[model samples]
Target: MSASSGTTAHAPSRAPWLWIAALALLVIMTRLWMSSAVSWDQNEQLVWSQRLRLGYGPQPPLYTWLQWAVNLVLGPTTLAVGLVKNSLIALTFVFMLLAARQVLPERTAWLATAGLAWLPGIGWQLLRDQTHTVMLTCAIACTWWLVLRHIRSPRPLGFVWIGLAVAWGVLSKYSFVLVAVALLAAALTVPAPRRALLSRGFWLAPLVTVVLVSPHAWWVLEHWDKASGSTLDKLHPADTPSRLHGLATGSGDLLAFLLLAVLPWLLMATYTLGKFWKAPAAPAASADSKHTSSLPWVEPLLRHYAIVVVGALALMVLAGASKFDGRWIQPLLLMAPLWALSRWPQAGNNARGARRYLTACLTILVLMCAIAMLAPLRDAQRGNGDRLNWQLDAIAASLRNAGFDGHGVILAEHHTTGGVLHMLFPQAKVVVCDADDPGFHLGCAWRKAERARAKGLPLLQVSTETPAPDAWWWAAWPIGSMPECQIHNLPYRWTDPAQAQMQLEFIVYPADTSAPVSAPVAARPTLHASAHSHLQ
Candidate 1:
């Protein structure tokens, strides 16, 4: 064999693991630097993490429980919460590394693994949003690796891991069921992996998964509306014309988003496969022998990815899903390189292509890290009042000044404020009245607040406002309806006029149990009545 061919045939002596280590460290450091405040999703996650229940809001309890554990160790600072998410993101790449090593040579494996980190969906959306989907993404990556391991070397432990991972992924998000379906399809159709279906260990997997997720499944059964409402809300059927229109728009948008999500990897994949299509056929292997030989494990893995991604779009088109979020497929993006190289096996041996791919990924990774580091500083300097710079400390102090001693129920008109208050004052009662949950009236813990109100414990009422606010003006009535209210319009101290032209107001109402709580006093401004009507 020639020198370059020889290099492709064997693993390199020098370790590429150190490079992965450095990238992992960079991921953590960027997260810590970006961890000044929680985003809308992070703050919302805090609401779910308030307890270790089997279910929270629309999603399962695992991610929140994971956050709860992280909070226990690191405390609930933004950095600690962010670290939990960033660590999961790191594990995703690690799992990808393991999966890639199963199908390709060491150098190609490293390239594929590192390349996943730069996929716009994985690198940008997953890292920035840090949603429950992050956990699902990690679980899927692990499942892929474990499934490949079992197929490559049929072990019972691998099946156990696949079960555990699928369970974890399902617990993280219901959308993960798509990935499970993909895996099942792989097992059913692929010849070598098809043998796993008959294995006793394979049969044991579903039982293990069921046992692992039974508590949350039970919770979903008990609280169907709360658990499934958000998901169902998006799946409404459309009329024929509407469905056709949505099908065209949604498919086009989904394709665009998918392309953007996969980015340069998709481009690289297309380029590599194009070369494969153009290359002259090798006449080495006999036609019958080549046709009969077992397909590479990567083939079925790619099928799983296609079934989840393309099959999902097909179903959505059939169901008339009006819109699609690219982040929905973020978990599957890791399989892009595998799918590409599987279609064109010889492409994995292209040393020049491998170097170019790694370089592009590194460039994107560094550029993103720099942007993450600088964006917040710029926002803070501009006083944008984005979550990273939200003045939670000031809000806490304002509550104290209003005679809230971290006791009784504290009421806020918005989940953002309520969630932040809950995190800041763990002992105090924070009630958010803005939940879409049918069971929740004002917000979660409404019943708890009602009992406290009956007992006449003070309910510290607070509401925030911006200069040119939209629908948020209506939030005040629910909190304002309390009896004997004193309103304080405190200036929002978080941002400069240059950063944001918004001032937050706090209205502190003392709950007097001696008097019955009635409707808002007629003496109050007509704006209150107008706001109440809007809510109705």
Candidate 2:
């Protein structure tokens, strides 16, 4: 009772929390609005939005749903989606603070919230507006909410939050398994919460989660082989994010995620390790009930936070035995900070105590945000805002330049290039290059068929978008009688069918390009195969 009263005495300061939260929100809103003008994932997002299905060719549905919601509310713009996603990310700080407050004082909570507001990876992801990051953030918040609920009141309702958490985790991204695993570990670790499993509530969570995910599962079944292969390729990563860089990536990601949360995380991590090391004693196994003399209101929460940290992390590593990218482990980052701060030792003086721990985090967070938003600074940084697609322009120019009277068909294997071409040159008809997806190949076929209906003549395919990567085509030209082909084998397996590439070199079948030129047009400017490799 004395411990509870003492913790109540150290209740968080509303003033500083409000000030920091407001500033953090301001920064969030600014970054979000700034990102609205152009989209990094615009092409994929546009496709997903229009298609409107449970699953996509590669990505999960979270970003699409987010994009759809943003478009519905503010109407469509690249910037608007960016802002919305960023705002949602920034809002997660409230969750962090609430979670922290259960373990730390109000002041510490605010500081932690402030730190999280601009934590590098978290802030960066919010601005980027990708599905993986947002889904992970939602999953983390759900986890925190469930943990606190169980600690405060372990019941069937508490278990219901767990199920909801899993549902959102799945809907957001298939990686919700990691979040579920963390929750399971959290439920088991805390003594008060252990009863959760014995009740009907435990299995109810998984059952509800499975029911919610049935549609996506069906979608996967519909495109079984392709989906499985793509997912596998993504997990194992053909391009080498092999575990070493993966570890550094995860560590760096943690630092970034923890950057803006507060000094308490810094203090707690330092305090625990420094004390545990310098003092050199095993933390009491029964420290939860007795620790109130030293720790705060919900010391159990802190202990659970540690279990969540390690458990979620172990699950992440096991999963990453197949996948990488720091963002995928986002939920882990969020939970880790909460765990770190919750363990923060109580110092007699709150002001000096918080200042010493939180100063670096807050300072760096604000400073980096300013640097990121600075126009010149952003441009100078690699992977910052300046990157643009020259490939789109090149593809558009080739088609436009090829046409004698500016009337011809432009086809592409994907809608990305077609959409880019449409945006770049609205007058030209852009069609999907795929032979299989008729809707994709329809535009060019419709244009050519219309022309033929008016005056019968064979259509000509203007240019293929296969120049740069297929540079080895010269060696493989007349690609017949090759040893690999003779064995009915292949070299450098490309993901798509040959119909996927623009292979027609003036052949009648795929729509020939080299018909006789009209008079006054000099010899059709022949493309040197060698120059094809120079494409940037």
Candidate 3:
């Protein structure tokens, strides 16, 4: 098909929005229907959402804050978490489509948006378990669209919006700083973006970002060690004999992760488009040069992205960092589809090719939805234990039978279990004994537990197994003797009664009516290595 004919055939329409909405709804419904038990990351959010705070563990507060707001209305059910997650995912697509349309033909723009479904991290991981990364993806997509729009037509108001988007990005995840800096560097390499950056209104962008990010910035300053500790641990070299060895390992890991995250879309696009890498035929004198130059932003965007990735790898090697997660590179490569299509616009000019590409993308998404829906049943049949297979309802029932009474405090060994318990018993205060920071006890749940104990309210301790004598909870609140523990082996949620069962142990410490009412301990005990290892 000719370029004009292809553009007309796949003209801009509301069809893309409908597809995005449908996908979002499907994910939200699938999650609600799958199981009530939360995944590891979702449990972490539930634990953090118990109370509002400026910072929560190593990550920023944007996601947890949003979860708190959703839970306020939805009452801490799976629907609240699913709604927060899938809504951001929907926005990610919306922003990506808007950005693509700024430079590519409308049909090609839709292709790029659909193409995101081919990326494993965005298509599967986000739908399955990711939390903070989802919010960061949405913020990054918005920032990219706003920046591209400003490049097409600079306005003071546009700069202000850019600032707001950048602020949102940083609040979503600290790694967004790298993306923001790399994007600014990339824009400077291009003439139009450079001129736009030089515009007088550009100052508003930074000003707005600083104002919006300052409150959380202060909280980070006060709790720098707690906020950055986990991230540093992940980046720390794993007992390498030499820095050179660490560098080699870290570089290889970073590259492998980047490729895995983008290769599916890249390879599929190349195969489907036939000549995805071939240079386009020369434009005729009658061709509008203005329309050709509309795609000027893609070159710098891809170039700076490469520079940033290389620079990050080099820095990680120097710091002896030997580990990387696929999600870490998600924001950097989120625009891979757009870059691929823009590099060879002619490849996308064929109407038949576009149809096949969209069909493939839709097929992959459908498969992803199917996998998500049936994963629990598959695990049950195989007798494989996973988050979905957890029998949280049975566990909660057993605890109630032991006299929990839906009041007072429940101390859980791990954050995951704590979050599930919190969801089951929303009226009671739930605390993860394993999640306490060594230097600063930021978890208000701990204090609430102490006050509840002093008030002679029921206090229950729950764990997957019996806690060791020296467990962290013992040190936090010293009990005179180990209470009578009950062990229950309940069958997995969907598994047959004959299959392997989930083991749960709990100790119900009835109300301490004998102790005199007094203020809880002024200082918390230092976190022990055993508890730390259990958390890891």
Candidate 4:
């Protein structure tokens, strides 16, 4: 019998509820461990918490608002945020399993959910709240809903759903534009969906998204030239680590990282693909006309999703041509766990291949979760200096004790430190504005790049190799790329020996008379979240 016939004709003896329950239980446990578990993120979350804007300058306010709400209700403790983040992650997996069930077997759906829960990205999101996970989950859910609608009707509502999903995804993170692009263009990949282009609902979605995102739109309107443009400049070949080299770095990590995220989903998705890709040679004698033994109409939907997955990857490669972060590809990562879970095991009722893979994946996850859970392990990880670049707390404390209020604006040689300090003091206006660059150096820092100039006067540039002196010398400040002498140095005393270990720490106290006063004025900018449909 054809796969299409399987859906409509007779209900199989397969035990679906049990499989779904197993998936749900695992997802719950996995999320509980992952959340309240992560202590850090690159810097985006810090910016939002510090500034507390209607929308963020670069990122949309959706994730920020969502997180901010959680923080408000639960208190802004990392543990609190982690809990909510973890819960949202679990929800995403739940929906992913639902999506998997529509096409794959019970066994395959379980496998996909397992793959997704164990995906490293999902783990990271669980450990800490990532806007991408929240937003992308919505986008995928929207996709699932839209496809279901399309299956039932060629109505414009399907397109409207696509538009709204894209808009909301964009609201969560700027990167979601790629998904929107892919979704809008999905019709071209599959012949059946082309009819959606003509639907009134399809056109209406963009309009609704725009209306919803107008507040943020105005923010971008005012500051894109000032802030967003600067960020884009950093992606140029010259500003960042070598483009190819950077991509390769992320890709290597991605290869292993994404395997966990998407591989399972891929397996699950394939179950559906396999079913319809090569179904019955002719209509089954026992099947109804609506339920054909021939290829089910559902084949196109699977193919459409496949095209979306592949198309999104192609776009990422193009985006990565400049620079990439593993997190950047997160929107599409949901598919892996789904596909991975859906593969039917070759063995008997014993469940071999899928079960074995699931077990192996879960075992690795347990080790990782263990490593993350142990208090000693976390403390060790934080100060280990193997992963983190420097200990900002120690450095900040030293400056504060040395008569600095922890309120002064920071000028750093590298933008990362500037970014760090910005997080350190949300109340202060930390600007790369010294060089007209607006106070940061690269990556997210340059989002306000147009404002920075090369003002060659250097900040306190601490070398990575040298053990920092107890007293920061006025001589440590450099006139050029390398400091002629160490100037304005300060010493730090740690209660624990663990804190004394040194790493690279550069504090640029820009030589400005009004540094203190100017910071507060600059910190006044509000959040800007844009959701526009005009894609060039």
Candidate 5:
């Protein structure tokens, strides 16, 4: 039997591509309409994107480099961030579809790609609050696709592409090493993949990876504490009572992470396909059969996933790790849908079943979009708010009205506030004051802040909470005395009568006598009453 005999009819040649593009557009539009404020991860990325560097704290520099590039073109606005994030998300879907097509029939490939929307990590969390994780997922997907293609028909250039993808993945997140190691281990167990790996051109992969990653590697060596300290602290927490207890906790967390990341796709597939685990009857051998069998590649891919999970647990036990975040396993679990579909290719033979699965995926996408669009209104109704609802624009206006030009230095209590301020006043130097750990401070921003202070330029300190006179940041006050702060009670973006106003306090330090006074503000923007009608 042909591949199509074991799968649904081929979809229109361009239908899947069009759907992917349309889905991307819908997500981007929804995010643009949701709120202008950046989420937590977005804020961190914006702050780091102020300047390019070889490394950033905790995470690798690739995502920051991309963000900086986008900001260079788009001027550090929310739109710049949104576009970069959504594009990676769309690329992820494209890569997954391409990889699936290599191992399964065309229709099954589309279904596998659609099934990604059912995973909460990819579907909702990515849209709402993930940054580096999104980039890493895209890189992993690209790597998988390239590796599969290379395995099917080995080529020297194919190894080069895989090398580039691997380098990109590592630079996106350090955890990607686990995936890479697992892939190699699993590939060695299979004949075709093993022979392909032994090819002379395979040496090019590591050479390319090392050459591309050398600069960042040097930076990590020089700044080892800054690069790996926080991650180590998280993995080996001081509070762990004992190794035995730590292993138990870590294993449990790892299991929970896998389930949360993969269960949605698994449950949804089972519901739609009905007992897909059952093995399908083998097709009778025929001389005219033209379809390449997927079993060789699919089996190894599944083994690769298994090794990733088992290896993660083993590392946790070895390192005595006590905590695990579900997001960390994203790259490994990203291909779960493809693996599930590959197990029984005949699962897609039912036209009604395929349609039902596609419909369910689209429904999830719509629901996620709706949730994002309505998030601000929901926060307002509940009388609690996050960064999204903060009145950053109004706060910026109030600062300008206070005879403070956007030319000096701003010290913010949190990175979220600092990021927003940096975006609003791109000319000003913004430093986050809340990083108690000296290792966490971004050296570039700190140096700029100090230089601006020494020059007696406009210095402003802003915070949501009142700062004590003895606060660490106050030590650098140019005036040598504590300045009186003006407290503004600004309403959130969405209005709820019962909601309390957010408190924002700011202090402006005196400038040098030789410094020119700021020009009088013209057409100061006033805060407007919240209109709930627009959101509805």
Candidate 6:
């Protein structure tokens, strides 16, 4: 519901710089001190950074391009890549504050800003990984703020920004298509905003957005399999659930997830509301103020927020995508605290409630940072590790010690292994041999390796398993044409002692013209037991 237009703006009761500064420091320190191993998403970005393009395997290129650019200046270390994500998160927090300020006073605005620390999706996902979805969260925050501003002020530039933000959001992740639809629907549903739909300003921003995103759109059209295939894999309907059952339960399950996600904030909001209800109500408005009441019953800002979230849930149900990642809906909740504060006017102004909100937010941040630091150490002690825990430098050195002259291609059956090799050995073309799996295939690299084979370059097949007679490589080259191959069992140990180890071996296939390089004859590396590891 809309607030009275005649409501006078009060002076902000507090400054927000301290909250911003604290958040900045927390982001910086966590990225610096957290585990050295990159998460799955971060590792993918590192691989994507090696070859910059407008589109990559089954996703848009904006986030990967951003990482590549950031890594250029910061170096491709775990900290530098994480800083790009942290910076986006910091920007999202600022944008959230700005959006809140439009509908809320400075004190409530600060509360909403700090409340971001409570969203696990924001805290854990944004802090831990620099993925396309994280970038989409930042884009969504910026878009919503612009959309709200445009609803209030009807500025041409606001629409342009809304258009740009939506375009960027979609380019970051395809799911943002839902966000763009929700914003447009919100604008059309409300009469004041509906009027602008016919205006030139309304069309200008979308036109600019179309112009900007046209190149990427062309790339998507050309690479339809990559663009759409990834989405299908995630949303693929399960046969076991039965279509009717999935449809029946999807929306309720989604709504329940949303409720549980915000339970902590809801509790605090309820307490503030309780205190507001007990306190004396404000005096009745003057009769003259009736004419100043806002149009469309609901504030367009709140209307847009509700519409976006509900619309997403509705879409999910209709599509029968019963399963969803909780973090996917993070962008919709950016203004949740602001919306709550607006609903209970007293909560926005209550000094005690404001203090408690800040304190709670700070406490959560501290606890999360401590957990982030300790979790990896605990994982190490337990002999657990993620894919990123491997010793890439050592592996590269070991490969050099064997017959690899740094002139051939290194092909691995797993994306995890290939991604690390690509990052470590920039000179060699690292190819993922498992092209049969659509999700892991890098078409360009696979083709490049084939071309390299035609030129008689050495090919090293690296795998965790021993070479079998009937592997994909065997099919690629005829038995008579195949180069002389030597099996070298090298123990690839984890750099972190707390992490487990594996027996990774390299199958060296020398070029037809070249002599067989001597293997590690006397020095057999010690291998550790293969322990379980989690992927991010």
Decoy 6 TM-score against native: 0.81
lDDT of 4 by residue, 96-155 (tens): 655655545445555555565555566555333355456566556556645544534656
| True lDDT of residue 65, candidate 2 | 75
Q: Considering every candidate listed, which one attains the maximal lDDT? A: 3
Error of 6 at 130 (Å): 4.8
Model 1 reaches what TM-score against the true structure?
A: 0.81
- Candidate 5 regions exceeding 4 Å error are 1-12, 279-293, 435-449, 465-470, 478-480, 510-536
Q: Report the candidate with higher lDDT, 2 versus 5.
A: 5
Per-candidate TM vs. native?
0.81, 0.63, 0.88, 0.59, 0.89, 0.81
Better of 4 and 5 by lDDT: 5
The predicted structure with the larger TM-score, 3 or 4, is 3
Clashes of 4: 58
Rank the candidate models, highest TM-score first.
Answer: 5, 3, 1, 6, 2, 4
From the highest lDDT down, the ranking of the candidates is 3, 5, 1, 6, 2, 4
Cα-based lDDT for every prediction: 0.64, 0.48, 0.76, 0.46, 0.75, 0.63
Q: After superposition, how far is residue 281 of candidate 2 from its true place, in Å?
A: 11
Candidate 5: tens digits of C-alpha lDDT, residues 18-49: 99999899988888788888868888788888
TM-score of 3: 0.88
Worst 10 residues of 3 by lDDT: 527-536
- How many residue pairs clash in all the candidates, one count each? 3, 14, 0, 58, 0, 0
lDDT of 3: 0.76
lDDT (10s digit) by residue, model 1, range 54-74: 887788788889888887776
Q: Which lDDT value does model 1 have at 358? A: 74
**Candidate scoring better on TM-score of 2 and 5:** 5
Looking at model 5, report the run of 10 residues with the lowest lDDT sum: 527-536
